[model samples]
Target chain A: MSSSSNGNGTPILELSDVHTYYGSIHALKGISIEVHDGEIVTLLGANGAGKSTTLRSINGLNRPRQGKISFQGRDITTVAAHEIVKRGIAQSPEGRRLFPRMSVIENLEMGAFQRSDRSEIRGDMDRVFELFPRLHERRNQKAGTMSGGEQQMCAIGRALMARPKLLLLDEPSLGLAPIFVERIFDIIKQINDQGTSILLVEQNALMALDAADRGYVLETGRIVLADKAAALKTNEQVRKTYLGET
Target chain B: MAADASVPTLANRLQRPSVVGLLGVVVVGGAAALLLKNLTVAPSRFFEVTLIGLTTGCVYALVALGYTLVYGILELINFAHGDVFMLGGMFTITYSTHFFGLHHGQGPATILIVFATLVLAMLSCGLINATIEFIAYRPLRGAPRLAPLITAIGVSFIIQDIGLAWKGPNYITAPDVFPHSRVFSFHGVDYGWNKLIVVVITIPVLLGLLWLVQQTRQGKAMRATAQDKDAAAIMGINVNRTISFTFLIAGALAGAAGLCYSLYVTTVRFDQGFQLGLIAFTAAVLGGIGNLPGAVLGAVLIGLIQTWNEGLPWHMPGSDWTQSIVFSILILILVFRPEGLLGERTPEGG
Candidate 1:
């Protein structure tokens, strides 16, 4: 909620000259970006534009082969995926990877796997319930049985159970109805406003630009443009190329 | 790991409930007739064989549970589980008599010595099971199914070799430590304290395992990890650790079975693991792989069948045909009802 005291505006997450590979194929090529504290930053791209790979690298699922990824002024480029989550970064991964056979309450409990505080964990469960009451209503139902929107809510709620300082959401609007997309975007903004820094990757450029404070455009493993959200919204190339405007 | 069994054709048609319903009636009727005949012809012998079969069946059920637990999570039929059980039995003999200085007629002190041996054997076997998972199976987690499945067989032989080396390829006698006195007599048939002890050990282990899976946090993680490893990882659950923990628990169960078998059966051999392990695996599949209670039920059924085949006086097949009979049951179960007696028939596993 407050600006940096140093006045230099140090980012909470910084990636400098990062490169990642899937075996021999280079997936991320020297991608560099900074996410400042208390701001919703988004990555906009088309298919195979390395947007998901970028998030994966930041979360330590795909380790960078070169350069560094620092989170809160510490190099975490090669940290294990589970350890990264423990260090205060939680991801609602692509496709809303909810544990299908597990109950809604059980899925949320899994999010707080590394945490041991009984009272605080219970309190966060209450907060998640407050944010998504549908989940609370269906707490005992298996997650796979829920509708798509409800499953997405459970996925996000599962992440929030970790009480992370930074949340990385990948394509939260994918495969959702228009109404649900709007609701998901609202939840994203609400989560950010509650003191968590967010870095989102989305293909829905119009919605992402509207919600994000700053947006980065990636094309085939490279960032083609980095601009403030308002500027990116009105840019001629972005409007034509991504927004389906001729 | 579910195979695409989409094309149902004729085989699936034969499995339709309408047809199976008729088959069920005939089978039930025949079984009822057999039971009535056995009861009327030799009532005392019938009671004795049934009691013996149940005791043997419960012990086998313990081993079947180990197989089911690992398969439930990993979908890998750990051929090595049987060897682990064998080694666990070996450890019981070595730890109790050699390490703990246990002897015959030690009075009430026998309980403390037996408890100490059981714990030591369980702890060692649990570590061995975890180590096997870590070293042999963890690396092949993402490989094609056949690779890990073959690896399991190879690991099985390796563990068997270790057992062979330790016990020197012979039938080693388990010390006759269980009290020989009968608990009760029924129609001149005595049920001994030794059989009671096996039940005493097995029931608690099964209960403890059920509580662990149904109630504990770790058990929840295991279910999640089994359902989806990648999703579990994203949720910050250490997928590898959960898997290893599963092996540890399965190993402990095998240890209990080892102790039970050696005491109740009165013998342990280096090669006993494979023969008995096969029976337990059959039991797991009969109950339905990945289902816990199904495994015990399957084991009990198999045990009863084996004892009846060998122990029946009228028209009884000798002990030599026991293997053939058990294998026949396995094939019949696999063909007629592959999902097993207790296994839920999921659409994807068609």
Candidate 2:
């Protein structure tokens, strides 16, 4: 991971020791992470390892009881969830929580809810359609009725409509066919190439490590390993536990 | 947008030979027969009754739309909405009688005063409904579904009591300001200016609301929030504010209904909102609770059914059975198809 001292300046998103709880359960315990201006940072973990929880803390859905979070160097530790999106952060949340009754175009329009520039929104819609041609074909289809891969594509496409500076994607390839998985990863890379930083949470370690520039291995609410994606991919413990290597 | 060919469509489901479906067909067919018989026997009386039904349905549609709007966003029945409608009528009565001293036969001046009263009542009720949401609903949002539902019922009683205190036990009457002159006539059945006035105002408001919800940016936000609050928030939509705005719109609709009922019916009591509210609620449910057009359709259908039963000449159940018939339809709907006529049949726990 590129630190501030390495001439990268302040990271676009920085979390310092964020603690989050789900009632009595300590979901995220003093976890700190960073994503620079144009890098894809992936958080890889087993179930209950707080990977999703960390993203939740950063996005303001699950407010951290302890620690500071900043985007573009502005304090947003206690900001409301909707305000987080207004500050150029958007999430294709877990389970692809698309509005079931709404058509695909309607869902995309919803992504630009905070935006005021009416004419520019159409351009963004076209850009999203360009990215996912499958979505374009099914633009009138209800989000819930689509197949899993299509729904995931729609979810990512919906997030992109926000024109976010930092896109928080939770398991973009959780339940997709192999072909869709590859296509999604390629789009993720293309999205990064266009200058939006990303914080990706994924259980698919191999695919996530491949797409990400830097990788963090989270275990039981704390980040255990933080290194370049290449290095983490070759790490002995990561290979064994996460990659399913016997 | 098309469902897979193998998947049974709504038409197919309706045609499927289930007991509920069979019963529905029989009931609908029987009602159709009765309606046809009544129409053939007394064409002019039927048309007059139909006009009256349509006018009453417009009022119920306004109130039913309120119930549907709140229910669409929050999935809460918002029992107090009827009381809000009641208060709207009271507001209209107060403004027309005391503020404007509006009486019959004032010509164009009366029109201006009535219009002003309509605006004031709508604004007042909208603010009140929003306030009710802020106080009663917002705090219990994270609580279980029953918490908010119970609170809504409680709020309904509170609003009713407030109405009771404001107008006393007696019926608050509005001046007979709406002209009784016939707009059009056929076979001695005159469509009066009062009835025409109700239709003229209602159609525009309903259409405007449809445009707002379907076409506008804020409407998109509202729909997104209704579908999924968390996902909507992630997309930069303010869920709470959207919910509050929904209540505001719903309350405004009830207020308009109140004004119409006061002017056309000319008499509104404090507890009337509760009875009317239930009928409207039933209308909303019948049309498919969360669906906008569905509520209006259900309201109109119920209005027609009520009037037809009372006004028709041949083997009619009459006015005394209106409550029983309406409630029975509600019960049957709940038992057979909770999704209602226009609602999508979402699998339970899906």
Candidate 3:
């Protein structure tokens, strides 16, 4: 695996030699990565490849058994998950775990749970609405009743409400139709363009690499390959297994 | 599908203002007439019954808050909350009697002592309940729903057995801390100062809790955690801590209510918690399990119903059947309006 820095500057989020466990089962094995500011970084893997474990570890949903996770120059390896949010890291977890009981607008408001300033929260909400007009239209509807694409919009919108410096998105296109998947990726790029760095995890390596600036291929619980997304897309090994190329 | 589609329409009709208004008029008018007729037989007896009902109802509401708060976060019935309430009363009694040596007619000093003692007792109970959750409930959180439920029941029984072993099957009298002074009179009605004291203390605490939940940062965290634990955690909420806080608040409320009940009723036993817990649970279910204001409304309504039921002249059910009637109503409400009077239908799969 390649071990070169982005060369832009110091990373926004740096995980060094991270190890994670779920009860007795080891989930992450010495994972290390650095996500620089304003870059789209994708972690590509099959099921049980520890992609979700990595994302969860960053947010403190699953604490790393061994390693240091630094965000924005602060050591946050042992910080509580909610405190992590207060430090400007927000995650849209797998399955779009929105508050099914809350309306779309309420879900968005919850995204600003740590935010103290109402005006800024409202402004961010408006920006989210602008990004996903469908959410704006169904703002009062319960999130559970929406279509999968619409729920994905709500999930992303909720994450944006945190005004996060780095947004961790786990499986944003997990269950969406192909058209919605494209739309979601386009929106992710737009979010990154607007200056929010993204750490995206996806099973669909092709779309992930297409949108990501750099890519890391995770096998089992280790990073097996790392390269620029364009080069990885054309790599012989990546194509044979992940791209289904002959 | 057709039946499901029409159910909301039917529910909408039942909840309409016109229907409620008509029902209110009939029930209130009939009750007033019945009470008036009964006034000729024994006014003092009627007054005593009314007082008893009011006192019991107030206590029920206090205990109900505990159930509602716990249900709001965990969505699990904390069967042991009532026992915790009972423990609070017992603790208050022990402390006030042994430590302070408090007695009746000591006026404001005794009241203050009892109040402070009760607050401490409540705080301890809250901590204990939180511990119970951490030990027994947290690990089982993602397991099947029934698993936690059965554990809760087991915890309830364990707490009860502990209380029984500690205190024995004895009905202990609370120290007469507050003086038996009639505070005021209104138009031939002598209002006992004790009733005023309970109401005065309880109203402010309830209002304070209501405000805390509705307006604070911690409040938002609680609501978010309740909505979705995983999402809440991702948003940086410490789901475990929030849940513990919920249990703490609920336990404390129950403990305070227990203190109030012991002082007003003048007697408390380990077993009292079971009956009171049932009534509070009924109130929570009546008001809609997870809704806060609904619990308060349900408590007040249940209180008034119990008071009015006992005070009515003709067709008045005796005190023995009060619980039976209350439970029957609870079952009927569940069958008819399961979401409760004020609970909205929560959406699935956020």
Candidate 4:
């Protein structure tokens, strides 16, 4: 995962043999992944496979007990969670963790909390509205009252409000309807195409493969397979396990 | 077809009224009837009592806001908050009389000294509160809920002891500096400058607090932190600092309320904070603990209830029954609508 010859110069985010723990129980064991600039990297895994833990480690919510995580070529392994977001990496965390009582507009405002540019923040908010018009329509509505798919949009929109160079999304399509799942993947690709690198974690293997530039298969706190997205889609092992094939 | 048509009517008749709603209507209607009866009997006395209630309620509202602010963020009851208020009163007395030689009939000088004392008391209490959070509660962040609950009680006792030592277990009195001149007179009912001054000072502080919580960027952070601490942290908000700031604001509020209580009443004691703090805490719960405006409403209502029970010339239970009635209402609110008046009802027990 850390070969470092992607021709995109230095990778925007690089994790080297990171190991994280939850109390005494080991959650992530020697996991390594990378998202280069302008690329969509997907982490494909089943439940309890340490996918969310990997994102937490990168976001500094769960500091890795061992190993190094560098973002834009600076080490962030020991940085505080809030400071991590300030360093230009924002996550639409697992569970979409929107402030339930807050209105959609306020929730989005929280995403851009670290940014100081007032006019640019307004412009970015408008841009997010363009990406998800449903949010603009329900800007005054409480985030908790929205449908699951709408909340997912609000969560991603909130992260975009931070104007991050790297966006970490954990299970954005989880529990969404099939149509919504498709729309979410489309937006993920659209977001990547617009120049922010993405690291996506998902269970919908086929759609993740379709949208991602690269993919990694994780199993029980370990990355079992890593390759180009197109290659992983056709890989026999990934097909039998994560792809739900015979 | 007849049965089907009747079903809609039956459903409409049933509506949303539960036993509790019916009970609420009966209680409110009964209270209104009693109030009307008293008003007709002695309008001047009724108005006088109501004005006193409003003034006292303003002070309670300030303290209640402090409880609600801390509770909203950490879900801790902060039993020590009331004692912090007692400290505020002591600070006010020491700063006003000893430092400024403030006395009655100073006129314009009284206002300046009072304002200076208010600022000093607020600043001292705010720092004390923030320090308490840093030393006492922050370390127990990862501990169970009961751990902090007991710690709050322990902290309350420690503060009470400090107050006891500082004032030597005696009632401390402040200089009665506010003018006794009438602010208004109507139908033989007189509202004094002393009372009007309390309300005037309270309105601006209340408005300032509302603006700070609702409009400022820091206020948004406080709200976000309150609803979800982890989510707030992920949003790049310093959760620890926000909690500390919340304590600071809550303490400052307690300080302001302390000044009002001592100056208006002209007498204070070491043990008064415990009793008044419980009343304010009850008010917070009655109005919905985390909701700011609800705290104010609850405090005012309690104030009115206390005054009317004592002052009104009617078939009332009188002053001796005041505590019983307030606590009874608290019990009723807990049993029927634990969310308080304005609190949103949340699903309990998962």
- Winning model by TM-score: 2
Worst 10 residues of 1 chain A by lDDT: A1-10
- Residue-level lDDT for B222 in candidate 1: 87
lDDT of 1 by residue, B203-273 (tens): 98899989998889889888888777776876777888999999999999898889888877767887788
Q: What is the lDDT of residue A190 in candidate 4?
A: 83
Candidate 4 per-residue lDDT over residues A54-167, each given as its tens digit? 999998888999999999899999999999889999999888989888899999999999888988999999999999999999999989788889999999999999989899
lDDT per residue for candidate 2 within B1-350, as digits (tens), equals 22345654455565667887877789999999998998899989999999999999999999999998898889899999999999999999999889998988898998899889989999999999999999999999989999999999999999999988888999878888877889999787999999999998899989999999998877888888887888888888788999999999999999999999989999989899999999999998888888899999999999998999999998889999999999998987776667788887663101
For model 1, what is the alpha-carbon lDDT of residue A81?
Answer: 80
Give the Å shift of residue B342 in candidate 2.
1.3
Predicted structure with the largest DockQ when compared to the true one: 2
Q: What DockQ does predicted model 3 obtain?
A: 0.39
Candidate 3 lDDT over A118-157, as tens digits, reads 9788888889998998999999997877888898899999
What range of 10 consecutive residues in model 3 chain B has the weakest lDDT sum?
B1-10
lDDT by residue for model 3 (B224-291), tens: 79877878987767889999998988888887887788888779887889888988888888888888
- Candidate 1, residue B188: lDDT: 85
Per-candidate alpha-carbon RMSD to the true structure? 3.1, 2.8, 5.7, 4.8
Predictions in order: lDDT: 0.85, 0.89, 0.82, 0.89
Where does candidate 4 chain A have its weakest 10-residue lDDT segment?
A1-10
Cand. 2: chain B TM-score: 0.94
DockQ of 4: 0.50
State, as a TM-score between 0 and 1, how close model 3 is to the true structure.
0.79
Q: Point out where model 2 deviates above 4 Å.
A: A1-7, B1-16, B347-350
Indicate the DockQ of the complex predicted as candidate 1.
Answer: 0.44
